[model samples]
Target: MTLAVLSGVGVLAFAGFVYSGVYDVGADNAHTRPVLSLLQTMRERSIASRAEKLTLPPLHDPARIRQGAGNYNAMCTGCHLAPGVAETELSKGLYPTPPNLTREQVDPREAFWAIKHGIKASGMPAWGKSMKDDYIWNMVAFLQQLPSLDAAKYHEMVEKSGGHSHGGGESGAGHHHGGEPMEHDDADHADEAQEHSEHTEPASPSTVPEHGKPGHHH
Candidate 1:
């Protein structure tokens, strides 16, 4: 009876605290040290627990890293700035500033999980939705080497990659993550589309519609 009464009192106190609106939710208003510490701990433990059992793939392939470079430059630079890039407006404005992955080394399993399944209320997107698992792993591969790259080497790798190409016909356009369209260079769109088309098997002549044939008249 005493334990039940204490639990009720604690619940009421928590409810009252929430109702009071004492904690500011504004981005400009930083969380108190204790609150920040608690959040950090929670996030870390949650990610670690989920990623603990993940089976890691080979993350040192040159081709994989190269592909990851282009994807990262096109998709992630705005939030997680590159080696040469000091900061971006989006990165700066976000309440929890996105990590500069260029200098930060992250555990590959945790990185893969985080990239695949974004953190709640954080600006990270679930790239797994539009990106194939292999592609996501490619990003992980690049991340392992990111901390060691200089600006020039980074740009070179990105240039060599098939820019902004998500395999299986998911183009950079029309894919919404966190309610925003994924952005890439207009010049690269033609190349990206071409790359995607190349991966797709062409329809056999027998399967082609009569009206859709090159010589067919309307």
Candidate 2:
């Protein structure tokens, strides 16, 4: 009888708290220390648990890292600032500032999983929807080396990567937009296509939605 009464009161208190609308939900309002700690712990445990299940691929390949440089520069720089960049307008306005990848190194498994399936409510987008697993891993490869790179070296690597290639027909190959089929002529991009084929089968070209554009927030 006592347990049931306590439970009922607890439920009522929670309901009242919800209805009060006293807690601020605005991004400008920062969470209390306790709440922030709880959230950080929850996020870390969740990522660690899920990341344990992923089988890591070889992430030290030079070609893969080079490919990743271009994608990272084009996609991630706005949010996760690069070696020379301190911050951007987008990064500044984000509720939780995105990590500077140029200063931090993440575990390959965690990086791949987060890149593939983005964190909930965070600015991170699930790249897997528009990108293949192999391409995501390529980004992971670059991340492992990111912390060691200075501005000059990072630019050089990106330049050699040919810039913003998704490695799965989303690069220079025209996308399937406006009901048009993507045209990939082997004669035109024979070398590029061949290089991409070495990693994974070519994915049919599809337009990435505005929200699904490749970028990592964590």
Candidate 3:
């Protein structure tokens, strides 16, 4: 009987605390110390528990890491940042700031899970819906090696990767394509049509190279 009474009282007190309107929800200020600690503990524990059962892939492949570098720049750099990036507009505004991946050492499987399935209530977006698994893995692979690179090396790889500014392909399937999809398709079709036309045409005397072009001189 005593235990039941105590439980009822405790429940009421907890309910009163919640309904009291003393808790601040604004992002401008940090969470109260105890609440902050509680949240951190819960998030860490959950991630660790889930990661234990995961079998991680070999994340050291150069090709995948290069792919991941491009994806990260397109998708993640605004929040997590790359080497030599001092700050980002989002980094300042997010309440629990996103870590600078360039400086932070991330566990591969945990990073994969977080990238594929974003943390709840955090600013991170889930990439799995739009990206293929291979792409997600590539992002993880890039992150594993991010700490060692400088800004120049990071830029060089991303520039060469030819990934979408916002997502997977030139179509930018993961983000808005802004007419580029049809444009690209039309361009490809035009090239095909031109090739067909060229093959069927009789070569005009003036159009024939006659082996007189500079490279053809040999």
Candidate 4:
């Protein structure tokens, strides 16, 4: 009886493999339902297996949350906007749109690991090599607080948090095409000039004149 069942299963598998000729390897075509379902299942299992051994640090402090917000805004907001924040034109067309990490559905530690290691074949790239471990941990700590964060407060925290600007690719799935680098260069030059002016000595005291007078004594 067992041999008969095995034989039947083998025959079914063979038939399915050959009859499912609709498999389009073209990038333009969306994955078939069965293929998509299988991929999703595999993705979940892969995440669970890899994340099982991850050790998360305690992330209870408000400061860490604030820092994480900075990282999120500069690195993540483009791909995964805040709850009330809307998506920009560039994010609309990515093959696998980025996830909204601010939602309660995501676990902080899991989010952190995902951000640090990134998912393979997915648009997400591992940040572990680029970002410091402390930064990754701070991001995890921040994710824990995202669900409770209001738009106003999230904006404030991000504005106040002092950190380096992250490249757009870190946000999630979308690609930041060229042209932005030119804008950045111009901004950088302006910033340098402003800094130089701020520290430079004031004009000669001789140029100072008496109040309410034009080259004349008061």
Per-residue lDDT over 71-157 for candidate 1, one digit per residue giving the tens place of the 0 to 100 score? 776677777877677775577889878898988999999999999898877778888888888999999999999899987787667
Question: Which residue pairs show collisions in model 3?
Answer: none
Q: Please give the CA lDDT of all the candidate structures.
A: 0.72, 0.70, 0.66, 0.59
Ranking according to lDDT, highest score first:
1, 2, 3, 4
lDDT by residue for model 3 over 127-165, one digit each (tens)?
A: 777777777888888888889888678766665554432
**Superior candidate under lDDT, 3 versus 4:** 3
In model 4, state the lDDT of residue 111.
74
Off by over 4 Å in 2: 167-218
Q: Candidate 2: what lDDT?
A: 0.70
> Global lDDT for candidate 1?
0.72
Lowest lDDT 10-residue stretch of candidate 1: 202-211
2 against 4, candidate with superior lDDT: 2
Off by over 4 Å in 4: 1-29, 165-218
